[model samples]
Target: MSKPNIIQLSEFDITQKIIESLSNVCTRAVLFSVKNESKDATQIAEELKISLSTVYKTLSNLEDLALAEVDKFIISPEGKKIKQYRSRIGKVEITVDNLEPSLNLYPNTDNPKSSL
Candidate 1:
Protein backbone atom coordinates (compact mmCIF):
# COMPACT_ATOMS: atom_id res chain seq x y z
CA MET A 1 0.00 0.00 0.00
CA SER A 2 1.19 3.53 -0.67
CA LYS A 3 1.65 6.08 2.09
CA PRO A 4 -1.60 7.67 3.18
CA ASN A 5 -1.89 11.42 2.74
CA ILE A 6 -3.11 12.49 6.16
CA ILE A 7 -3.86 16.08 7.04
CA GLN A 8 -2.55 16.91 10.49
CA LEU A 9 -4.73 18.91 12.82
CA SER A 10 -3.70 21.17 15.64
CA GLU A 11 -4.83 20.96 19.24
CA PHE A 12 -6.98 24.01 18.84
CA ASP A 13 -8.97 22.20 16.19
CA ILE A 14 -10.16 19.52 18.62
CA THR A 15 -13.91 19.48 19.02
CA GLN A 16 -16.66 17.78 20.99
CA LYS A 17 -17.21 15.26 18.19
CA ILE A 18 -13.64 14.04 18.49
CA ILE A 19 -13.88 13.77 22.26
CA GLU A 20 -17.12 11.85 22.13
CA SER A 21 -15.85 9.40 19.54
CA LEU A 22 -12.59 8.78 21.42
CA SER A 23 -14.47 8.26 24.69
CA ASN A 24 -16.43 5.30 23.34
CA VAL A 25 -14.76 1.94 24.02
CA CYS A 26 -15.93 0.34 20.78
CA THR A 27 -14.85 3.30 18.73
CA ARG A 28 -11.48 3.43 20.42
CA ALA A 29 -10.94 -0.26 19.81
CA VAL A 30 -11.84 0.06 16.16
CA LEU A 31 -9.57 3.06 15.77
CA PHE A 32 -6.66 1.30 17.43
CA SER A 33 -7.20 -1.88 15.39
CA VAL A 34 -6.59 0.07 12.20
CA LYS A 35 -3.91 2.41 13.52
CA ASN A 36 -0.98 0.48 12.10
CA GLU A 37 -2.64 -0.82 8.99
CA SER A 38 -5.81 -0.23 7.03
CA LYS A 39 -8.50 -2.93 7.20
CA ASP A 40 -12.02 -3.55 5.94
CA ALA A 41 -14.97 -3.60 8.33
CA THR A 42 -15.13 -7.42 8.22
CA GLN A 43 -11.51 -7.81 9.29
CA ILE A 44 -11.99 -5.25 12.04
CA ALA A 45 -15.12 -7.01 13.25
CA GLU A 46 -13.36 -10.40 13.36
CA GLU A 47 -10.27 -9.00 15.08
CA LEU A 48 -12.29 -7.07 17.62
CA LYS A 49 -14.87 -9.84 18.03
CA ILE A 50 -17.73 -7.43 17.53
CA SER A 51 -20.85 -7.64 15.40
CA LEU A 52 -20.57 -6.55 11.79
CA SER A 53 -23.44 -4.14 12.20
CA THR A 54 -21.83 -2.59 15.25
CA VAL A 55 -18.53 -2.27 13.42
CA TYR A 56 -20.22 -0.57 10.52
CA LYS A 57 -21.98 1.85 12.84
CA THR A 58 -18.79 2.71 14.69
CA LEU A 59 -16.92 3.12 11.40
CA SER A 60 -19.56 5.53 10.19
CA ASN A 61 -19.25 7.51 13.40
CA LEU A 62 -15.48 7.57 13.16
CA GLU A 63 -15.60 8.72 9.58
CA ASP A 64 -18.05 11.47 10.44
CA LEU A 65 -15.78 12.65 13.24
CA ALA A 66 -12.70 12.60 11.01
CA LEU A 67 -11.02 10.27 13.47
CA ALA A 68 -10.73 7.57 10.85
CA GLU A 69 -11.03 7.60 7.07
CA VAL A 70 -11.22 5.30 4.08
CA ASP A 71 -7.62 4.83 3.08
CA LYS A 72 -8.24 2.85 -0.07
CA PHE A 73 -10.62 0.61 -1.94
CA ILE A 74 -10.05 -3.01 -2.87
CA ILE A 75 -11.64 -4.77 -5.78
CA SER A 76 -12.62 -8.34 -5.13
CA PRO A 77 -12.74 -11.06 -7.76
CA GLU A 78 -16.50 -10.62 -7.79
CA GLY A 79 -15.94 -6.98 -8.86
CA LYS A 80 -17.18 -5.68 -5.57
CA LYS A 81 -15.64 -2.65 -3.90
CA ILE A 82 -14.34 -2.85 -0.33
CA LYS A 83 -13.25 0.15 1.70
CA GLN A 84 -10.15 -0.10 3.88
CA TYR A 85 -10.21 2.22 6.85
CA ARG A 86 -7.26 3.77 8.66
CA SER A 87 -6.83 5.95 11.69
CA ARG A 88 -6.19 9.60 10.84
CA ILE A 89 -4.49 10.47 14.11
CA GLY A 90 -1.44 8.59 15.22
CA LYS A 91 -1.60 9.72 18.84
CA VAL A 92 -4.02 11.60 21.05
CA GLU A 93 -3.20 13.25 24.33
CA ILE A 94 -5.82 14.54 26.72
CA THR A 95 -4.78 16.82 29.55
CA VAL A 96 -6.93 18.26 32.26
CA ASP A 97 -6.06 21.61 33.76
CA ASN A 98 -8.20 23.29 36.38
CA LEU A 99 -11.01 20.87 35.64
CA GLU A 100 -10.84 21.70 31.95
CA PRO A 101 -9.75 19.25 29.30
CA SER A 102 -7.39 19.86 26.39
CA LEU A 103 -6.59 17.64 23.41
CA ASN A 104 -3.56 17.20 21.22
CA LEU A 105 -3.59 15.26 17.97
CA TYR A 106 -0.71 13.82 16.01
CA PRO A 107 -0.63 12.79 12.39
CA ASN A 108 -0.66 9.10 11.45
CA THR A 109 2.42 9.06 9.30
CA ASP A 110 5.69 7.14 9.13
CA ASN A 111 7.64 10.38 9.34
CA PRO A 112 9.39 10.60 12.71
CA LYS A 113 8.84 14.34 12.82
CA SER A 114 5.12 13.80 12.61
CA SER A 115 4.90 10.92 15.07
CA LEU A 116 4.23 11.51 18.75
Candidate 2:
Protein backbone atom coordinates (compact mmCIF):
# COMPACT_ATOMS: atom_id res chain seq x y z
CA MET A 1 0.00 0.00 0.00
CA SER A 2 1.08 3.54 -0.61
CA LYS A 3 2.08 5.69 2.36
CA PRO A 4 -0.51 8.16 3.59
CA ASN A 5 1.69 11.09 4.56
CA ILE A 6 4.87 11.83 6.42
CA ILE A 7 4.96 14.71 8.82
CA GLN A 8 7.87 15.89 10.90
CA LEU A 9 7.07 18.30 13.68
CA SER A 10 9.43 20.22 15.90
CA GLU A 11 6.94 22.28 17.86
CA PHE A 12 7.29 21.45 21.51
CA ASP A 13 3.60 21.41 22.31
CA ILE A 14 2.61 19.16 19.42
CA THR A 15 5.53 16.82 19.98
CA GLN A 16 4.68 16.61 23.64
CA LYS A 17 1.10 15.71 22.86
CA ILE A 18 2.19 12.82 20.68
CA ILE A 19 4.62 11.62 23.33
CA GLU A 20 1.94 11.75 26.01
CA SER A 21 -0.43 9.68 23.89
CA LEU A 22 2.11 6.91 23.43
CA SER A 23 3.21 6.88 27.03
CA ASN A 24 -0.01 5.41 28.39
CA VAL A 25 -0.75 1.74 27.91
CA CYS A 26 -4.49 2.12 27.62
CA THR A 27 -4.20 4.88 25.06
CA ARG A 28 -1.60 2.91 23.14
CA ALA A 29 -3.86 -0.14 23.09
CA VAL A 30 -6.75 1.88 21.77
CA LEU A 31 -4.52 3.41 19.14
CA PHE A 32 -3.16 0.05 18.03
CA SER A 33 -6.58 -1.59 17.96
CA VAL A 34 -7.81 0.78 15.26
CA LYS A 35 -4.64 0.88 13.24
CA ASN A 36 -5.80 -0.99 10.18
CA GLU A 37 -9.56 -0.50 10.39
CA SER A 38 -12.18 1.75 11.86
CA LYS A 39 -14.18 0.55 14.83
CA ASP A 40 -16.77 2.03 17.13
CA ALA A 41 -16.35 2.41 20.88
CA THR A 42 -18.25 -0.80 21.54
CA GLN A 43 -16.05 -2.78 19.20
CA ILE A 44 -12.93 -1.37 20.70
CA ALA A 45 -14.12 -2.05 24.23
CA GLU A 46 -15.07 -5.61 23.35
CA GLU A 47 -11.83 -6.36 21.56
CA LEU A 48 -9.71 -4.99 24.36
CA LYS A 49 -12.05 -6.20 27.08
CA ILE A 50 -11.97 -2.73 28.53
CA SER A 51 -14.95 -0.96 30.03
CA LEU A 52 -17.09 0.99 27.59
CA SER A 53 -16.65 4.17 29.57
CA THR A 54 -12.92 3.68 29.63
CA VAL A 55 -12.88 3.13 25.88
CA TYR A 56 -14.74 6.36 25.31
CA LYS A 57 -12.40 8.22 27.60
CA THR A 58 -9.36 6.74 25.90
CA LEU A 59 -10.71 7.55 22.45
CA SER A 60 -11.31 11.12 23.47
CA ASN A 61 -7.78 11.44 24.73
CA LEU A 62 -6.38 9.97 21.54
CA GLU A 63 -8.54 12.29 19.46
CA ASP A 64 -7.20 15.26 21.38
CA LEU A 65 -3.73 14.23 20.32
CA ALA A 66 -4.80 13.70 16.69
CA LEU A 67 -3.82 10.07 16.98
CA ALA A 68 -7.32 8.74 16.42
CA GLU A 69 -9.95 10.21 14.13
CA VAL A 70 -13.58 9.56 13.28
CA ASP A 71 -13.54 7.83 9.93
CA LYS A 72 -17.27 7.70 9.34
CA PHE A 73 -20.67 6.95 10.78
CA ILE A 74 -22.41 3.64 10.29
CA ILE A 75 -26.15 3.04 10.49
CA SER A 76 -27.37 -0.22 11.91
CA PRO A 77 -30.43 -2.00 10.57
CA GLU A 78 -32.25 -0.82 13.68
CA GLY A 79 -31.66 2.78 12.56
CA LYS A 80 -29.02 3.40 15.19
CA LYS A 81 -25.95 5.31 14.15
CA ILE A 82 -22.45 4.74 15.48
CA LYS A 83 -19.22 6.66 14.98
CA GLN A 84 -16.20 4.66 13.91
CA TYR A 85 -12.64 5.68 14.61
CA ARG A 86 -9.51 4.81 12.69
CA SER A 87 -5.95 5.28 13.68
CA ARG A 88 -4.78 8.53 12.14
CA ILE A 89 -1.23 7.46 12.32
CA GLY A 90 0.65 4.19 11.96
CA LYS A 91 3.98 4.82 13.71
CA VAL A 92 5.76 7.57 15.61
CA GLU A 93 9.37 8.41 16.28
CA ILE A 94 10.37 10.98 18.85
CA THR A 95 13.79 12.32 19.62
CA VAL A 96 14.88 14.49 22.52
CA ASP A 97 18.30 15.83 23.21
CA ASN A 98 19.41 18.79 25.29
CA LEU A 99 15.78 19.60 25.91
CA GLU A 100 15.10 19.82 22.20
CA PRO A 101 12.36 17.55 20.93
CA SER A 102 11.26 16.46 17.47
CA LEU A 103 8.43 14.21 16.38
CA ASN A 104 7.88 12.22 13.23
CA LEU A 105 4.38 10.92 12.54
CA TYR A 106 3.62 8.34 9.87
CA PRO A 107 0.03 8.31 8.77
CA ASN A 108 -1.69 4.96 8.45
CA THR A 109 -1.22 3.24 5.10
CA ASP A 110 -3.41 0.68 3.36
CA ASN A 111 -0.92 -2.07 4.08
CA PRO A 112 -0.30 -1.98 7.81
CA LYS A 113 3.02 -3.77 7.53
CA SER A 114 4.28 -1.29 4.94
CA SER A 115 4.46 1.50 7.48
CA LEU A 116 6.98 -0.33 9.62
Q: Local error of candidate 1 at 60, Å? A: 1.0
Top candidate when judged by TM-score against the true structure: 1
Model 1, residue pairs in steric clash = none
Q: Would you list the C-alpha lDDT of every candidate in the order shown?
A: 0.78, 0.77
Model 1 vs. true fold: TM: 0.80
- Those runs of model 2 whose alpha carbons end farther than 4 Å from true positions after fitting are 1-12, 111-116
lDDT of 2 by residue, 50-112 (tens): 999999999987766656778889998899999999887787787888998877778789434
On residues 46-108, what C-alpha lDDT tens digit does candidate 1 reach at each position?
999999999999999877666778888999899999999988778888778897777777877
lDDT of 1: 0.78
Clashes of each: 0, 0
**Worst ten-residue run, lDDT, model 1?**
3-12
lDDT score for residue 82 of model 1: 98
